[model samples]
Target: MKKQSTTAALPGKKTVTAIYIFVLAYTVVQLFWWGILLHQQSKEIAYYEQLELTHRVHLLREPSEFMREMQRHHHEQRMRTLKYIGEGTIFLIIILAGASIVYRAVWKQMRLQQQQQNFMMAVTHELKSPIAIAKLNLETLRKHKLDEEKEKKLLDATIRETNRLDQLCNNILLASQFEHQNSQPFFEPLDLSQALGNALQELRDRIQSHDILADIEPGIGMEADKFMITLMLNNLVENAVKYAPKGTKIEVSLKTEQNDLLMRVCDEGNGIPQEERSKIFMKFYRIGNENTRKSKGSGLGLYLTRKIVEQHGGTIAVRDNLPKGTCFEIKWQDYSLQPV
Candidate 1:
């Protein structure tokens, strides 16, 4: 189904702030009226005093004082009704303000998710041409004669880039589904080491050309959607390779960090700038640092990567790597779905 545009679904932050301000002003006006009119809710001693004074002035009967007191009670009741009306009005204003804020925030998020889906579709299209080119190159090589080792190397390159493109396409699709709450994971007890290794193998040429170095640990395992694991690893590794400078080593280390399955990919590039760090996972977030931007990206890779991770009950974060560069770490819980 076609999705609604995000621009129409979300109220801008300025609008939310304006509504808040108006609510506050209305509350102030209500309180001001309260102060001017019936400030005290307590029974007024002055009412009784005025009644007694009039009684003494006219030597009035006891029944007249009682009647005057009754009139004072009626007056206070009417004033209270006005105050209650003001209070109710103020309460309605407060409630509407809260409801509008909630509606705007949630509506904006849903629209953003739809836009992300659109971007994913675009990314899938971008990936196709490169993959077809790689495939054609590989197939054409089989038709020609070449030294076995060199041909093997070229074949490897084609395969690696093709796999990278494939992984990226799959990530976009999976992320789109997950973001829309449509991904139903086929979970089973699986090996993390193998899944991560598969992604690394596909990226070997990219890693070698970029001089990225990896450290792999065996026996790290998690129960997750196998496809999602590969997609997640692909994003982390690709992102590291893309940002790190030429000849700098990129490390992929996996082990159980406490109760979570921890996989870390670190790059020895110029590193992410501090200011733009918080927005790195946003759908269109890109670094302001000129060095990283030099490398091309769809800007949705990490965003999609994180979505897949979240689907499997995992967390991903980026941090500065020691003195320089950046490191991304993912932690996944080990939980199994019981067979039905």
Candidate 2:
């Protein structure tokens, strides 16, 4: 089966409208320039001819000398009109170029607006559901007499839902922090292996459908914000679990290559199309519409993860996992690492 790429289609209406405007403006400018020149030429010709007629009828001057003078005047006027045409064409081209630039800016702004709308819808749903579930669990506990085990289960469920809400809120806050360019991250030396372990454990509890395989190398420490690094790792693993098929394997590995530390999380899933690989990290950009999406996310995870990694002077990328899935790879050079 052939996989379809998820490249976003251009805004057809906007594109066509831009093109139409360009063509219309160009045409109008050309037509007006030529029309004005032609009208002036016709009036000049009529005046010259009428002046010659008056002179001939009154016998006021030599006809040959008058004819030569009129020819000179017409020649000079033609040259000036030609020069004006050239200048007008150049000016029109500049105006059209400016119009093109404005159109591009407007198009980009419209797309961003659409993404923001989607983000709002997704975030609202994400927040509302967890809060509602926690409230329902609390109400159930208060309204009924239940066994100790059942009561404990309900309370645990409530706690879990509330925790989910907390995580979502944290992600939003972290994303906002990253958006502000001046926000500084506190970094310190930490054990990368331990952080991966903790992130994987948390993800395992959150998503039980996928099995995670960890192949982490010990003694690989780096200077980073441990909390943010853990959050990044958790987001990656959680993303894999969400998209990958049930019971499929999700793999996490950390290793050293020359002067770089490479960390990868891979999964057996319907992989992202090549075209969409770059866009998945954009804020408020999910692969599909929020209302129709089966997967649960606010679309800020990968964006925040990328920002966190970049703050540490690391790079993150996505590639196809061998056989049948996607792989997210992160690499940090030795320069990016610091000892405790």
Candidate 3:
């Protein structure tokens, strides 16, 4: 089915074009008016000069005061014309600059709206797929009598789908909280190693195709919310699983550096381009178009991850892994050890 374009509904292109045309036409008209004013002032000066020359010739004995007064009047007239032109030029430049700013703001808003529309569609599809799959499995279980191993496999699949749904819902809620700047998580000492283990365990069934090489530092702790940290790690791991090819290894580690905790996730996948590194953390800003996207996501994972990291006085950064793939590094600042 052909997907409907969200940007098609926005209605500002024609209006913006008209505004630009009007500004251009107004600028041309102002320039033309200035040219005519200058021509008229020159003509007047020439006419007066010719008259003074004739008067000087006809009345050679006339006083020099008349010529002095004529010169003074011409000087004042020239100054007035110059002042008007200067003020008009400044006004036109200001108007053009203001229009450009407004146009850029409107363009950015339109892009954001389109991205949000895409997000809604992606979320709806993502939610529906897991529910539909789980429902089908349930119906099959109720209708058919399956053997022991087969039944277990079906049950595990159903559980995996359910877990996916739960994760999706949590992402939506966390994204909403971050969007509204209401992410005041209860901070305390959290075991970083345990959090990584739990997060990896949650995705063990889902990541059967890839190998996870974890080298976590033992007894490493930091000031953070455990649940939030788990969610953040889950998101990063899930993202790596989705993007990285099957059979490639994913690396996870945690260590301390100068009173800060450093968490790292490395995946052997097609690395993110340098230009798109900064934008991946914006809400609803996906790398590709939603209509033809191959990956299953609502584009909220990295954004929520960044928000969670920031809430804990931390920073997250992306880098190219040596040889191939992408690396995600997170640093938590002002870390405190758990009490003995």
TM-scores, all candidates, are 0.61, 0.81, 0.87
Q: Each candidate's lDDT (Cα)? A: 0.69, 0.81, 0.82
Taking every candidate in turn, the Cα RMSD to the unseen true structure, in Å, is 7.6, 5.8, 3.2
- Please provide, for model 1 over 155-263, each residue's C-alpha lDDT reduced to its tens digit, 9 standing for 90 to 100: 7778767766766667656656766888888898777777777767766745675655556667555667887777777777778877777777788887655556677
Order of quality (lDDT) = 3, 2, 1
Q: The CA-based lDDT of model 3 is what? A: 0.82
Candidate 2 structure quality by residue, lDDT tens digits, 1-340: 1011112434555676778687767876776777688768766876786676566755646678767766776776677667767767786787678777977887788788778867887788889998898889888888999999999888877877877788888898888877777557778878888888888777776666889889988777877798888888878988887799899999999988888899999999999998998899999889976656788888899999999898888999999999999999998877444333
Per-candidate total of colliding backbone pairs: 1, 0, 0
Worst 10 contiguous positions by lDDT, candidate 1: 1-10
lDDT of 3 by residue, 1-340 (tens): 3353445553456676788789777876876687678768866876787676666665655557666656776786678677767877787788678877977897788788878888888899898998999999999999999998988988998998888899899999888887788868988867778878778877675668789888887787667798888889888988888889989999998887777788999999999999999899999888887777778788899998998888888999999988999999998776655532
Better of 2 and 3 by TM-score: 3
